[model samples]
Target: MIAVPRAQLRRPLLSSVLHILSVLFVFDLVFAVTSRSLFSACASLALVGLVAAVSNAKYESLREPFVFTDLSLFSQLFSHPRLYLPFLSVGKVVAIGAGIVLVIAGFIVERPVLPGSRALVWLAAVLPFALAFPVAARLPLTLDPYVDQCRNGFFAVFVAYLLNGLRPATFRRFREVVAAGPFATGKPIRCPDVILIQSESFFDARRLGDEVAPELFRRFDDARREAVWHGEITVPAWGANTMRTEFAVLTGTESFSLGYARFYPYAFVRNKIASLASWFGRCGYDTVAIHPYYADFFGRDRVFPLLGFARFLDIRHFASASRAGPYVADASVAEAIVAELEAADDDRPRFVFAMTMENHGPLHLEQVLPGESSSRHTLGEHASWRDLTAYLRHIENADAMIGRLLDHLRTSDRETVVCFYGDHVPALPHVFEKLGVNPQHSDYFIWRNYGADAPERRNLAAEELGAALLRVVQDHGNRAEQPHASEKAT
Candidate 1:
């Protein structure tokens, strides 16, 4: 048998060690500006770099040989090579000046920069290679030079700016992009009294399993036949931005469709919006909007007027307070709606829009029901299953409130209609990873569950919501007169 060369045996290990060191070195240089301690910074960088490298190598083989350009490597290594020059070198002078400033600041501040503190900065600088190595190892090594150049150029500049400071203009431009306004046609469809309830994080999480809030699912089934329930409606922002969803639904426009209204109440101040309330006001319906939160949270005080509501009732207007999570309870908000409806002038039909706030954030089972004695384990605390279970319990509470509202409407002399749906999905950041659901598959989830006499199937957006709701009112009116038509036929 031929003897294997010792060099061959050591080559793979040597390459890995070099690769790890290179990654750590890059991290050290970038992080040194903040960390100041060379050893600690280098050690921290090595740990993170090793983690990334090993993880990538484990997932992807590193045995593949890749060709690279000499010029590209030279430029990368000597990004500021003049620092090594004797004198009168521009890059060297700049580096020396920066070092002097840091030294002075260190002495003045009297606090040494710690190891992990600047690790983020250093990691930011080397992130391009850290990101690219895995991809390159997984895919073919062709065009590696161009990839490295582009990644370094783009990401390095980004890191530098991030370390220094970002221009306010960047935020302004982003606001300009996201803050567009009046995303709909802005035309009113003449319809009967409109009742819109902005339910909190009201997604149909039941798709994960059959056991989540079974009673709530049954209630949804009943509500579908009683009203025009559209499933698969998309909400813009996930956790917060409640007002943006409210603005879109009320105005019959996507918040981002118009180049200015995407910033919520700020957009309202800039543009005159003819909302559902304004449209109903024109048709002689008494308009009122209610919320169970503090009035100033989203500048609802100013925004409601822009929507043409004659009255805006908030937490202050409620007679009794119920707590759901951090906000006023859905039950209390439902009770307040009844009072508002009772107090409205009987001559004109009323249009009422109310929002529930009990189902907001953190989603700890304890945060949800407060005094309930149910085992925390049943709620599934650390796991996605538990978070979802807790969320459904809150929905059950909201459903109970809806049941009460429906009972009250049944007894009232006025023919009242109710339209309610979720504002968006709950705040489970790990949901996509934990549940194995695709984020892009948001359109698949339906608000109205599979049931009898529901619309064949559809995805709902803010613009489509108004018309769907109008159809419900029309259907209700037609049903009310159906007995008379049967008698006439007889």
Candidate 2:
């Protein structure tokens, strides 16, 4: 048997422990700018690691406006890194690189944790401090919510991770909530066709309670006047996390009931539970979802099918579609909706969930004409920048798409109910900060091409929009034989 020096054994132990501390400090320093507190830093680092593990894309602090999101909501971030990596802050880039290096270094230098070792004893002793953190949270220096999390570095954040693991939401509870709510007792509509448009960043910027030129949202205002029932729906997200709003609209399930799963619904809600499409399917409708982007983006290719859509059409099928900026133009998406309707089997009603990507960001990438009329909607300072001008132009395109879709439906013989809404406000900090719109609110309107008096707009959450739509279509199904387009035009 070979004899090893005691000093050699102790040195390796020391190096391993020091290596762990050095790695954790990297995370602490990186998170200090955003978290500022021990618990938040621990949570943020853990989340970033999880995302890096699941998706190769780097987190963009400057472009993405979320820190507390779950893995499900981040699938879009996994898209070709070329689209997002350029906007990442330098500190975040270093931190992410360091985090990846540490992860690699961990495998190289790591030793198996022995149950009887001093490291285990130390871990056992310090873990009790998990309770002490909350108890000492009342004291200023010890908890240090006001100071940067780098103050405590490893111990406080480690303890925070331990404490957070104590409580987690279960799928069983999620099922109970879904079974009781969106799945409970709503009659399916008899309408021949129902089109729900989760238009990307399609809200009225003027609602920010800020000054804008009267004609800034000319096309949107025109649609509002023509709508039969329109309202202000409080969507699930703010600047980012399109999945949250989209999920809520399809399922009619609020994020509040989902706990941590709310941040990443796909991770938890995987089954074909009763959703808007499922409800319609039960009523003899062939459901189809159209999103003019990569199929796997935000896991929509998987989730939409599970949500009971019989068919899903993504970017691959739209090879001939025209582009406005980074994505297919919303006008082409509108034309696609008409094409889907025209191609649908005449035997059954159709439920079309059209999600447009024309107005999707980072708007900074777009090139816009200098001093265009849409320039008035920008923050006076950022008026010359690409982000503001690009968003204004993109949403203007989205407005035109809405008009095109309505025009086609208006002339068609079949009756259709169209529910249109913005997923969330664009993640434009300069514009939003100056304007002061409740970032959670987005505009929504329900329209039947046949025409009805536009109702007063009211506040709504995305989860409630589907039910509101159901009520609208179900309450007034089977209208009298309508006149031809030529007669109606007259």
Candidate 3:
């Protein structure tokens, strides 16, 4: 390792010191309010430790340091531990739990720091806030969370981003873009029902090794051959944070354009924006969103309406859906799509956007059950093979979901188009390391029924997906209105 100069380390060290002092001051405030030793000095340390533990785990999995926006997900830690907890080692979890217990026990036995007159106690409590204000105001920050996090520490960088996220200038560009309005897809003589599926943590796994089964993505390969457009797609997220990719594809907006709001775009959205749903709605199509998880997980329930979705189908709609491990199975989502189409009695075109939850990760939490095929013959008995095995099992269901939908669309008299893509690759860092592969992109395809197959491969950024689909739709419409030379002469 290269040695760093002492000068370079000074700022980071000072930042850590300030962060510790802030935590202590906050604990003192709590103790003053309670007028008991309920908030001990040890409790402050425990809180810092917990934040550090979570930050490290997230960094390892997602290649992103924890920021202020991540605080929005604290409730999810309790609501969905399986999704977030597995990233932390069991030892860290146990140690953090023990630390919290010890801190609480100290509250009962410890003595108060300011055991004096009520006026004096109140003065002691209020003094810290006054002192803290100067420190916070003087805190030098670059305001770039990823870089500032290293120089000014987690807490300071977190607060910096939080402050910046609230600034009006940060959203000025996005508001301007939204005001410009939706894409102008001219009036068409023919319109087909559109079904867009955002598959979770999906990538072509056969690229991992030659020992991998060729039949694994047979249905995916078949779809590619007949697709109007098919290829890899670069998304704005990794490991998790499905909404980043989701927002990009739906609105055709780059995440960076939102500034600090990019971390959780939905939370910042208060006005209607140009999006796939809004555009479709304007064209007289009934726009709907389907996801087998809580609609409010990422505030999608409130935000979907803003995006022009006429109906939002969430966990409530999938109460009886089949499960693959802990999530609603991909097959169940496919079934729901078909059910939605059949339920619509009117001849009005439909735009169904489904976000499938199967193949979501924390894959290491589950094991390969008995009789499951192993990739070890080629991968040679590594620890990560289990993750690969678990992934393959769930992916089989995803492939089956694709095949089933394609078959249904082919047989239906009503013309329909299916645009499918993965939000991001799975959180299988170890599996990727063992296989000597580091995938940076996920797969996508746009296929339509009632058309001759002329497959064209086109790779794109996540934001470009919506426009690309529209282009395909418009090309078909243009061709439909054209007359042959024989007809023109007549």
Superposed on all Cα atoms, the candidates' RMSDs to the truth, in angstroms, are: 15.5, 10.2, 4.9
Candidate 2 residue 172 C-alpha distance from true site, Å: 1.3
Q: Please give the distance, in angstroms, between residue 417's alpha carbon in candidate 2 and its true position after superposition.
A: 0.7
Q: Taking the tens digit of each residue's C-alpha lDDT, what string does model 2 give over 6-102?
A: 1122222323343244345444443332232344344445544544332222222222212223323444445656345555656656866777676
Report the Cα lDDT for candidate 1. 0.52
Q: Judged by lDDT, which candidate is best? A: 3
TM-scores for candidates 1 onward, in order: 0.57, 0.74, 0.86
| Colliding residue pairs in candidate 2 | 233-460, 234-460
Name the lDDT value of residue 289 in candidate 2. Answer: 88
Give, for candidate 3, the lowest lDDT window spanning 10 residues. 1-10
**Per-model C-alpha lDDT, please?**
0.52, 0.64, 0.77
Query: lDDT tens string, model 3, 99-136?
Result: 87887777777665556777776676666545555455
Distance from true position, residue 434, model 1, in Å?
Answer: 1.8
Point out the worst 10-residue segment of candidate 1 by lDDT: 62-71
- Per-residue C-alpha lDDT of model 1 across residues 253-286, encoded as one tens digit per residue: 6654532234343332433456677767766788
Error of 3 at 328 (Å): 1.8
